[model samples]
Target: MQRRLADNITSDHLSCPICRDTLKDPKLLPCDHSICFECLTQLIESSRRFNKFSCPVDRREITASSYTLSAEQWASSFPTDELSLLLLQTISGDTKTETKLKDGILCSDHPQNGCDFFCFGCYKIICSECAVENHRDTECNCKNFKNCADLAREKLRDAYDEIENLIITGQDIVFKEIDKDQLLLQSRQQIRSTIKKLKTIVQDFEKMINRKCVDILSKVDSVTNVEELKKRTEGIVKDLKRVRDEVELSKSLTSTKDILTVLSKIPESLQKNTDLLYSLAVSDNPIELKLELNEKFLNLCETLIDQPIGTVHVVPADTIDFEDTEATVCSKRIKFSSDVLPLRALELDPFLAIQLDPSESENKITARFTGVIIHGHSIIAIDNANFKVQRFRDTIENQFIDEVLIQGIYDITNIHENDDVLVTSPGKQSRLIRLSTYNSLSIISEKVTENAYFSISQLPDCTFAVISHSSPTSSKKRVNFDWSRGVTSHIDIIDVDGNVLKHFSENFLCEPNEFGDPFIMPLKSICCLPNGNIVVSIETKTNSFISCFNQNARVKWTYDLNDTPEGVCFDDGKIYVFLRESKAVRVLSVDGDLKPVSTLRLPNYFGDGYSLFVGRNLLSVIDRTELIRLYKLQSC
Candidate 1:
């Protein structure tokens, strides 16, 4: 009877009421029912808003005394089902013992005893007699077979818990991927439908043209037939009139010889007219009718056929793979040297020089580039003269691609992570514009600011650092006056919504002169570093310099330059400063006193460098002469 009852213990008896799976980490509920720990935690989280959860088996509501406990804690509050765990272990051990006993696994030294205990150090099973003799040492670390088995089972349970967590995370990722796939499929279907409609339109246009051609040809044929009939009738009437006049003249003569001559001539003339009429009736010659089409219209049609109706712009996928171990090892092994490395002069080979196309501008004004940036494989520039933003191919030819009109734009900067750009328009109502460059140049959002921002730069934390210059007063005469006399500028750190987070006004490149009056330099272009430092170019009548400021707006360091600085940008741990008078770019180290590294010289004919953009292996500069020059960095 006991054997039959043991055999009748089915999987349903061991299964949890919530999951219907064999009990694993089973917990006892208040209603005397058991559930899987993970399942209970999920249920508790689902009912957290109500502060009560109903049991799956009895549908009884259970409320926690305090809502401060997390879902895992609430699940853990329930006691573990020790009886189920014990029964599971017993069943597992019984099966293994039966197999070993049937196989007669006895110790070699003590053949009469069955091997039960396991010696961890010796890695072998032993009988009781052998355990007392060989595995008696404390270092052996021997334990009973049942205890060792239970410990192994606990480790397996921990591994299974980790696997369950992974399964949940993987399911979420798969669902997201499926959603993306559906969107792509929908887009493809839309494109196909659009193409089909375009094809139908073209076919209809062709049919209309064919109908017009047929109508024209039919009109031409009718005109040719009428003109031929009119010419033949006119010739016959003229011949008959001549013969009748001869007969009338002969009858008035009143002489036999005259009458005979007139009658003979009349027969000859009648025969001649008859012959002419016969020839006209029998003639099968076709009139040479040519239908001439307009040359310009035909050429236009050919051009339209040759060109594409729409463009397909392919955006690159944004994905990055990184290894944590490799990065950690590299960080530990690589150390930057304290000593300043030798300056490496990079040769700037002239790649291409593109003159701005005058026909592209609506106002027919000279191109005046105010800002320029390298986005992906194209060079984008703002033409202040025409209020246009133009894009050019970043190849050797540097061909013009397209342009969009944006009024009052002062500066532009690219956001690398997404193919978007931030543009600043400084005026009475200054605004910051965000544009999406994925499909085409289009405005996404705009934020109005209280202060007029001359230049804008993106920080590492995704905020913006903008510079606002105070307009000069008419009372000021001298160009290189002190701060109290000349115009000053301030920097404001603003979030995406155009709300100013931090403002710095007082300590911006301020130094006292011999008379104890502070000298404030006028700020020009600005850029941000990876470490959140703000660098701004300061231009003065005598000389120019670039200053680096920390997060608190305090000047960290300043590097003096010989010529006036116009534009500034940072790339690869270095600062590039464009000098207007010198018409060259100066590279400075971002560390250790901001020392000068090297100078990249431009052509003598190149105009004053207004803006500069650096790419991975290319450098572009726009000048005041309506020319954009590209250069290849030899050893970048």
Candidate 2:
């Protein structure tokens, strides 16, 4: 008897399907169907025709025509031509399905079995028993269900695409913002570099100027001392000569009466007269180490009388022992300083004149920016750069807390009373850099929005203004322009902490026509007066006049300097204004209603120049054809 595989048997010799195993000592039910005679009888009995399975394999329905086939009938019915190939194909498909089901790592919850269910919530895997056990519990600790987990996995592709697009777009925006910032920074750096060059030239030329002054003063002093001593000596010589001439005349008396009078003189009176004459005419009076003069010296004294001597104060600064390195001098009394052409945000459309048929505002006041100084807890100056200026009060402390190089940037334009620095580092690039004396430097603000040109100014009342202009005004007069106040310019007042307090056009300003309502501050130099009035130096916008307004923001006076005033300050009971074109410093009454009291003359031979007052005492004068003057005000 040969042994064979169970699957090799024909359908006529098929065994029980419930366990797909050979029948043991067979048990026959009353229906005469032989099945497993062990404890699996219940499983076998349920594998019936309507809704049953006699075994775990090949549980397809069994119709009357498919049941009880004879050996010859089964052989004819089964696929014979390609039976082996068809069966192998079926087995391969089943194997693939089983492999896919058990693809991932086995379930930790059911270590002995491969995972057949994917949990959606827990994002893990479990065998059938572990999954059912968790689900049957009221809590259902399973993290994920099979169906839901499939959905989450499908969403990943879409998410990846979205992230890619976002990254590309975000990078473009960041790059563009950085480009803009670098351009502005480069411009500022150029300005600083130009200033530095001029400063060196100014120093050299000023030295020559002071030396010339000292030489002239020296000549005047030399003449004065020599003349004073000679005059005193000459007076004594003249009196002595007069006395000798009188004695000679007396001896040459022509009348006999004078001779008889001389002979008749009493002996006692003669002795007294002789003694006095001797005293007056004595040349060898060793008792008179009193004075000695030769005839040649006397004659020289007479010649000296032709010219007199004078005194002078003009002297070379170099000749004086003046030592001050810190630029802390107040501009109040300084005539020449090192800081000159300090540039800040500005808005100008020289072509605007061509637009409104030359009807545009020729006045400029608000757009012009100046430096501010803040002094107190920490010293900082807000200048052209959009960062705070810092310094070390003590050298050792500075080494411990140096935040950045002052020369690293160019934005320090001004200072405040409290010294919290404000720099013009504008949007994205523009930052109010607060360099701590102890902490690392950081950018305080990030700008999501930007304006065209933001110029800044601060008043004494702790108020600051930002003047910004829109796109350039059209040069074409006939061009359609919505010049209504909003079209050209705007101003904003903000607190020290960057909160917007108010806008210049806050009052419902009526809309305008014709070259658009003159929407500009055009203010160049702003000097806050002790009386609360602001002396704002404005440029000619549309041929407008230079004007000064009261604290109520009222224009009290105006004077067309004709030349633009680049910087302005109050000093010595007067307003000192820097004239760029005129190359001069103009002094006016504090009210801005007077003529220049005095002008400090600069030698055009060297070069044209300008100056800005840094603090209460220091003046930074620059832009000279040859020299710059770092003038520190001296206490008179």
Candidate 1 per-residue lDDT over residues 1-636, each given as its tens digit = 634533344264557776777888988887767788999999888866667899988899989878788889999999886545544544455665456555857778866456667776777777654665577576675556656787657756887999999998999999868755764565578689999999999999989999998999888876646578778879898889988888878868968988997787777788888888776554566656777898998999999989988986543222211112110111132222221111112347888777767775567788887778889877788777777777887774648777777777878887758798888877456788788777678888888776777678889998989887665654423233345566668899987667899998835455555756455565778889998989888765454667777887667666556567777888887888787765667776766444455677664445666667776766777765577787876542
TM-score list, all predictions: 0.43, 0.31
Worst 10 residues of 2 by lDDT: 347-356
Scored by lDDT, model 1 comes in at 0.71
- Per-residue lDDT of 106 in model 1: 79
Error of 1 at 176 (Å): 62
Give lDDT: candidate 1, residue 237. 87
TM-score of 1: 0.43
- The per-prediction CA RMSD against the true structure, in angstroms, equals 26.2, 29.9
**Positional deviation of 261 in candidate 2, in angstroms?**
99
